[model samples]
Target: MIGSGPALAADGASTETAPAEDVTIVVTGEKQDRTLQQTPSSVAVATGRTIVDQNLISVYDVLDRMANVVVNGNRTSFSIRGIDASNVLGGGDGALASVYLDGAVLPKAALVTGPLDLTDIAQVEVFRGPQSTVQGRNALAGAVIIRTADPSYDWSGRARLLLADKTGERRASAAIGGPIVDGQIAFRLAGEIARSDGLVRNVNAGGDADRRKSETLRGKLLFTPAAVPGLRVVATYMHDRHRRGGLYVELQPPYAPEDRVSTSDLIDVTEVKSDIATLDIGYDLGSGLTLKAVGNYSHIRSHYAYDPDHSADPGQIAVIDDPNKTYQQELRLNVDWNWLQGLIGAYYLRDDNRGYFFGATQNLSLRRLGVDQSLLKLGLPQATVDTVINLYGSGVPIVNSLDQPRVTQNHAAFADFTVPITTRLRLRAGLRYDRESQRRGIDQRVAIDKPLPDPAAYPGLGPIIGQINGLLQATAAAATSYQPERTVRYHAWLPKIGLSYDVMRDMTLSLTARRGYRAGGSGLNQQRGQVFVFNPEFTWNYELALRSAWFDRRLTFNANLYRIDWKDQQVSVQLTPGSAFDKQVINAGRSRLYGLEAEFSARPTATISLGWGAGYSRTKFTDFDVGIGQVLQSAAGNEFPNAPRWTLFGSVTWQHPSGLFANINARYRSAFYQSALVQTHRDIRPLTLANAKLGWQGEHLGAFLIVSNIFNVEKPVTSALDPDGRLRGMVSEPRVMGLSFEGRF
Candidate 1:
């Protein structure tokens, strides 16, 4: 199991994940599944203690602050080693990142964004590189495994309250947990609430409440019957809701004045609710082995909304509503011998996502709006703007809404076995057979509102209708059937065999080769892009790793070299051609990626510990020729979109024998592009920031303070498409601070 301590003891519970439990030599990032000093893979683990100490609530906070993971929007669209995409519409399809809360997967991508309320968390494991052989999803890049502590039969609980003021914002949060029953049941509940005043001010729409207010609640329950000593059942539920104002983008050109972007009037409300219940039955076979089984069920639902430009324009209105639901059932059986262990399992995943979109544009004529310069500027307006909008209708309440349905049912059986031919040599192999039924379609209907009749005399003109009209109808249907279904059976027998050799007492080296995959889906929302289709792809990775400790166990090191061959890499691109159509997800031709990753831990004194993480990646599309080239070097290759080339995440922490505590943490990320196909933004660069904590922990009480962005770096977070094309970025987090107190009864 993953745990915690001083130097090596950091297992599953401890959040510090730093040096482990006081020189315990912790290790969970590798192929052999041993301590950091014993495992031959470069992994990063964060403990619950570290999370609380650092005041991290959501996955975004932890990834951006504690680990070296980078994401777009400063907090979302996660990416490890340049494997992430921009989430322009809030709903991004390139979410290759897999989230495993405990052992069950987080179905929807939005839930992975923010406000996780890091409470009762055991450990967070960040696996680097492809790991299709041992994980649930055949992740394209890697996976993040979050393991929470099990409910203890013993009664134990902790609670905390926090208050903070930064710049012009204030935040508050509180939580509590304890035992539900003597020795058979236990529970934990945690919640957080925070509100802030935004940094940007829109004089056009003034409001100090332009900031966001968020709330979250999480509960954990565990039961172990005395009559059934080995059987334990656990359940978890989480709900998070956030409403933000002033979160608007700008729009320029013929539609509005220069630098005129939407602001505060644009209201955004998003919510997430997740329910999970699991039962584990373990039995002792009475031999050198035991039997363990895990049965899990989880459900998550979320809704996101935003008003692009909050005004009475009647035009320029945009609304989107999405409700995603998922049901997953998985079972696993594990056997452990003296020198060998393995697990066999099967999973059933059902997901359905339904959404509605409404977008309206300026009421002005396309020629006047300058939508197509060739059509209007130089004399082509009729063929350009006039024709498109004329087909859809005009003026207020334009019927430009679409219904999108994405549903999938997939079933697969997979198993991975680890056998030790000797104490130092082992073999790992896995296979999976997947069958999926997928359906996705975009059904659109443009409302045609006939010219309003003369109301003066129309008092007799029957409801906005007039004239030659015994021939006119109240409603006209401009709709079509958009139904598409495809059944697929994916067969992949990913066989992985690695070699491990122990050089010294706590030193090891291993090499592994495995294959990863990306699921196939509908082509695109634009029916025009079906010219030449592409197939779902696969990526094969080869890795060599080393793990060791030296200098009287005071220093630890982990390093790996890997190269990936991505065939049929899927990429998303906008089809605007000469105009701006935003951007979307699509499968690219092919690609290649190679990199070096490493992590280190050192303790020169008894009270001070130092930790470091670094990575270098080169991901490119080797084969993509649609007009770009059969050998396309997209903006993605010139620069990895949303993924930094080099990142460093580390901490210098000091502990006093009298219980005083202090630590400084920082992250540095190299610059990368925001899109895969555009040279539109080449001036973009990377960013570096730091956070510090000062506190005291007593046997019964604790007090602490946190300061974020100590350097107050004016970080320029580049965007794929700013509301105004001239402004390349938006205002980023300037600085933040908070104070908190905790007590144990």
Candidate 2:
């Protein structure tokens, strides 16, 4: 029932039962389950009824219809094909694209926003480029798998409801499964709740500055036991909660440009909580062998605030208090003998991140001491010098704090194999050997003295209050204090290779190569108050793929071509552009990327169906020159910040058997640049989006009428510039109209 849109079940969420037709579109990117023409990388799969007919709720709406994904901030960071995985506001040591659900692994503050709920989801893979031989070191910019919906040997259920208009949204969901002991026990349950009224517009906090709420709960259990012989067990649990309202916009040249509004004098918020647990076990060592084990745990907590100087001034604001924890384990073995097929694994990870950053401190020395043009040369106007500097800078207490604790540890070993040289030639290989360690700690502080400002209530200003308290005590005596600690040890040895032939009867042809890495830590730049140690960064990928079919199968095609070579890349340099944690995390940079991907599907009759996907990339920058605040320029050739060189998506479906149905989807993108310095007014402009659904189906009831951004494109999914150069952004999601309902039992 992968619902909301890709034509597969039209809304029936059918995998054609029977062991879900042996794993529907399979290809879990080599962690077995093969189809999609026997997997050889470059993957993408979305089901759950194409995420409920493409109304996908987050994970950046499934990376905007996959195909060389990109999900920049608005859902925090993501990239693949421009290879991203870090820097959604710097500080990293892991994650270069890695997210898994059924196989656990998630918790980098739950990857910044999303309750990861697609009601009873079952399938969503996207593995493109280096996964480091089965996901090591966070896959180096590739990997996203999520699977759910297991546990049924009979009875089942479903329920859903949704409503939307512009930004007013409400949603509800439910799922259930059964066979408590019918096939040796099984159970499943799911829940969801969503709310929204967001899309910024805060005109001084008089309401809605990006509002939202989310909730989810899930449970699952499956066991096969009759006094255990071939053993099996699976268990899972999840919980999530989110509350939002922040990052509002407005600044397009001091408002007006059709001002979307935002001038928060207070109201800023963001909260999140998450918990996850998993356990899976299996055994059957008979002849063909098999054994597996998995265990995972995750916890996350976050609180965020904003308005840092996008002010109407309740005096600056800016907070973040994150807490995270993660643990994982894995052990696997599988074999099938006879012409071979294999797997072996071992993995472990531990992650813990503790964070802090508090703020309020941005008077920017009244435009660097010009003090409202010295109060209009003392005759005071300009609204009495802004009401005496907002009545003494909103009761000045100025503070900026930071505390961070990070920890990571990993150990890995992996292996993969598949062979058969005869029947149309085949071969595959894999390897992984990772060792990691990272530990960091830092605490920084700044506090602007206290209680002072009674020169008998400004009777002649006392030399402008002693020159603004001596420029706030020399900017809090040169701010940022640090107590650094470090530990870094990284080891790598990733490898993968592939080959395939049989290029005729329905075709197949392949070639692959990979190696990717990211590891190097120890930070705390605070504008070069120093404590840096950076290194690791690598990539090397080469791919070629084509999988074809035609006519008899009602057409299908796939294509991939790739190249990448990046090395040493780290880059997050911006020292002191008006304080507040002035950045630094360098490794310089070097890059190169090449890409092309394609896919097409067709059915042509029996009620029509079609699909298409496309991508093209060319991320430049080969060698960069850092230093931003005070210029050092030279960002090679730029273009690799939200990397977009082209992406297109398409879909169409129609069904009628007296139950009428229709679906259409479209997307296109091609303009990029949001950072890595190259302000052509911050670029980010290409856009096109379309979505539709029309329905009426019954067997167990269903109804739909969704339309999203059918044409109202506002683009700019995020942009920045403040530090007083003002020029804010955050747009997208302009038109929406929805109504959906479904029921089954």
Candidate 3:
């Protein structure tokens, strides 16, 4: 198990088969099935029973309780150890980490907008280090694998209803499975619907600013032809829709943490819809050999609209629409033998993303371009300079329309093997050759929204007016529509080697080294109206791990220590200071990161369980120089944004013989910078959150009371200075109490 914690049975009931220490956990993240203790990879596993017991409503909720993992406040990105998912190389076309549902890889936009609600799930596994050899591209940092429940021979069903206070949260979910043919076919179906008024109160709009709603449905079919005893087939389909309000709120005077209020006149909204389908087939050939094939397809669409100014006036609104589609196929053969065990696979993928944007918003970068200083240098009158400054200092509004489309195709062949060198020692090695090609195109248009001032109104100002008008027109022209298409190809060889030794009957030690990679891509410089390409980045990771069992198999302890060296990092560079539109991705940064993670779980008694996890990471740029404002600066010693140095979590659970149970859990994160700029004011403070559940469980029915954020700790998950010189950001959700009822039959 990921936490090695006390896990309930699949039916949400206490395990009576054996002691906690004797429980066996099978992990499949590595494209093979192995007991947790036998797997040398650094991974965490959470079962469906754990999700229900802890009230983990989504994947993000589960990530919060894991050590050395952080999800950004916006939910658009996450980080494993000190490596960010999206911003590791500043900004890029590919993510460092990938999320998978069933056997389907989720699209990038789906990571931000789609519903990741946890319903009828079988398991969730998080691989903490580089998975390049087995996962190929976009596995520079890690991967998240989720498996939903499948049909079984016996009929089974489960249902749950939930309600919460203040936020007006409500949820209903159900899952059922049964055998269609006594021994050949089976089917499963699951669905969920959820709604919440959200915590951020839109005071100006007279409603909740971050209201949310989601719907999810899934179905699975399993077939085992009686004639083909060794053959098995599984097909799955899922649909999800999610809608939510804005994630940010204005931070002004008289700010009340408990109130969670926002003053924006328009409540920003986003909606995402997704459809996914997967088919998996396996045939067991005799003699410990198996052949497997998988195919997946997914489509996701997202729409977003927001008030860019964060003010009460009807100023400017920004809107975006993104539609993405993906298809993947994989074929692998597994071998299990006394001397060696391994798998060889070939994979292919195609992804298409189409995005469109239309908006009218203020352009702060243009306002900061030293126009007034240039005018003064030209010997313009002080009064005239002041007038021009007043006219444009607040920023000039501009209308922008953009259409960006990207298509990518990947092909790879890989193999992984484990060999027994001795009775107590094992060697593992893996290699992959990957080739990827991407085609991206952009079409954008920009125009000033405010008309030029008339020179007739002021005497003796015609020359200055003409000069200002000319400058404004030049700026607009520089930002005008630019249509460009580019195709880039990247190829890489990824390899991994590791060794594991059984030091004792109940103890194991392992060491691993792996190379991680991300494919290179092209980006557009809107300000320069040009296209730029960046090189691929790589990382070498060294990890040491220990796994142990103690106290007659009642206690478990695991730890991992790792160091990562990164080179040719694709960092975002602003060619012109104070101009956001002049930025492009470049391979101009290097960094180093080291971290330690430890977790322990103990079942002191049959009814009592305890688990604790802690992580510490030190991250710094080793070689980095970039433009900041009007000057070049070095970030060699600065820590990565959102990478907290310390993170801790703990949980305790008690189940009484009288059908009553209780669970309490808490998580803490140390203060850390929220921006790569590393300013003192941009530091987000430390935060601690706790949750509790009290419930009664019977054979077929259960009820519980859940209290989240029990102490109402309201802290900013993200923070930045607004254009108006005010501190504005998104705050964590406040305390919420809820009741839930569940039934199993």
Candidate 4:
């Protein structure tokens, strides 16, 4: 939580002491919207100016610099304190981290992959901790709250373009904001377009089919009038479109990178439209009491169409359709109730998602490649049909070729109150009662009267299908013998509590414990042929934090140590080979996540500004004894996959305070893993990349040159098929260097 007072950027290990500076930033976690320096939690803020300087276009860039967070840009994988292994499905990723754009949630795990354009953003706030108490569900790790530029009765806008050299990727952006009606209403509109010639060339296909193209549009409207002094209405929407090269498994024996080919099986497509409308009503009813009411409604829908990265024949391709949707509404009213200040709020959310995956529905003849004649002439057996179905079901990941839709709903009402125990100590308490439910189901598909094309002429088909079913049926988990739809549901209630105190003249201490639950649903594999249902999981999070500033406010620091005991932990284990989705949810036992984080910002000199933040986390299975036994006992000593043991982000800004001609700024991040498998540790390691910018600014115009990955380093996150190391993922986005320009009158 942010502290409860004015905040000034502090020094390095020591606070900086120049003249007093007045800058107020909204803190996280803490009840009061205090300055960043006063926030009790380890929070980081990326100002709009900073974002512009670095060309930080998406959430990926934001997470990379957050404390203790590990991000793999390939598939847009991320984790904080090594507690993220979120499946790409609709439900939560269990990532322990959440993303909020203008206070609206980003679509599910899949929606966040590609690129996010940063055109008219106001500020980005990150809170690293169990955000359940304030953020609600899907906040197991922490929360990312992005606020875009709201409309202003005052007109404003910007148009910028960039030409890049990373395979010739070109980017252009524009935005406009101002009054829709003078002093009555305001609006802000922004859009971005970018395209690239990929690095890989499928020469056989004629061009680098691995190209990327994206376009984004966003708009906001604000309604406020002198007639309604303390009332304002805000509405916003964002639409994003993207097309990139799909995954192609480099076909090899047992499937390894040695036989790697930049396959183009899937064409990842996404269209996300978010709608948010909020009415903020504030009134002074006399008696030193201020009354306020805030209501919000939000909705999101996204779909993806692409191929798998792990196909036996890297040449094999499939067209898949995955769509996910969510709707949420919130209402809150707080008042200055004399000695006690409090707010009570209620929330409701609905999830409706559907996906259908079927391959070779549009098949091409590959029989001539490695044809087998002798065996085909002999006519092997009846089991051949079953084998083909089995292989067809499991062969392609991500494109599970099944229809499974998961629906979930949540209703909760929460309230927080603060009382002045003394001028030095303020007692705080928050309580929430939530009801969550999740339901999952699947549908199976069939081949159209598909009889073999005279196996006698195709002997190769015999072992192929036979081998397929043989490997698939190996697990009792899926009865490929039967084709039916299955459904499962889960329900739960969660609560939270906390305490805070101002211990000294410039220090504050706090402690909090909370419980968070994610409604469980059925698995996508249920569409494979059988029914498998699992229960929901919950977490009990406990934490302690300290915020302090000394040396006449020159030095400021905050640190937190936390422990979370999670029960019924959800684990995504694939039962079949080559599949990228989780097969089922098991009642995995308890686990613990503990970590420490700190941040320091200061103006070392009248002309220089610096900031540093870092975090270390150790997450492990403490007592994960499944019904069968301990699956993680042997893996106990090993660090959790995807969780980086250490993460660091730092920045330095050299400004002329005197309004000089030249100013430069820079930022960087250390390395982290990209996968959950300990054996593939080498695949994703430490990455050290930097960005620098030189610019000149004045009232009428501004210009700057931003250079990213200044060293032109190739820190490829190794995945052969998709961006994420799921199934057979591949690596993309080599060193991207571009020049950007902007000006205003």
- Top-TM-score structure, candidate number: 3
**lDDT (10s digit) by residue, model 4, range 76-143:** 55766666635311233334466766555665444354334566666667776666656676776667
User: With candidate 1 superimposed using the best TM-score fit, by how many Å does residue 493's alpha carbon deviate from the native?
Assistant: 3.3
In order of appearance, the predictions have TM-scores of: 0.82, 0.33, 0.95, 0.80
Candidate 4, residue 300: lDDT: 44
Per-candidate Cα RMSD to the true structure, in Å, reads 6.6, 22.5, 2.7, 7.0
lDDT of all predictions: 0.56, 0.72, 0.81, 0.55
Better of 1 and 2 by lDDT: 2
Write one digit per residue (lDDT tens) for candidate 1, span 1-745.
1111253243233233243335653443322245555454446666665566566666666677433367665344577666762221122242465676655666544543433546556667777766665553536667777766555544455667766675354445444445677878777665666666655445444544246667766677777778876666667666666555543333334323223244434344555555665554555555534455555555555555544334433334455555566666766666567666766777787777754343433232222222344334445445444443343233323344566676777677777666777777777666666555666666654443444334354353333223212212222132322444444434455556677777667687888787776565554333232322235557787889887788877777778888888765655554433332223444555667778877777767877777777778777756664443222344434545565667777778777779798888888877776656664754457788888889997766888887888887754564334332333234346677877777653
Evaluate model 1: give its lDDT. 0.56
Model 3 agreement with the true structure over 242-263: per-residue lDDT tens digits: 9999877765567755557777
Error of 4 at 67 (Å): 0.8
The candidate 4 region of ten consecutive residues with least summed lDDT is 10-19
Candidate 4, residue 527: CA error in Å? Answer: 7.9
Q: Candidate 4 regions off by >4 Å?
A: 1-20, 28-32, 85-96, 113-115, 180-182, 247-261, 265-301, 310-315, 354-400, 446-493, 524-528, 550-555, 574-582, 629-633, 657-683, 720-733
Deviation in angstroms for 144 in model 1? 1.5
Order of quality (lDDT)? 3, 2, 1, 4
Best candidate, lDDT: 3
lDDT of 3: 0.81
**Arrange candidates by TM-score, highest first: which order?**
3, 1, 4, 2
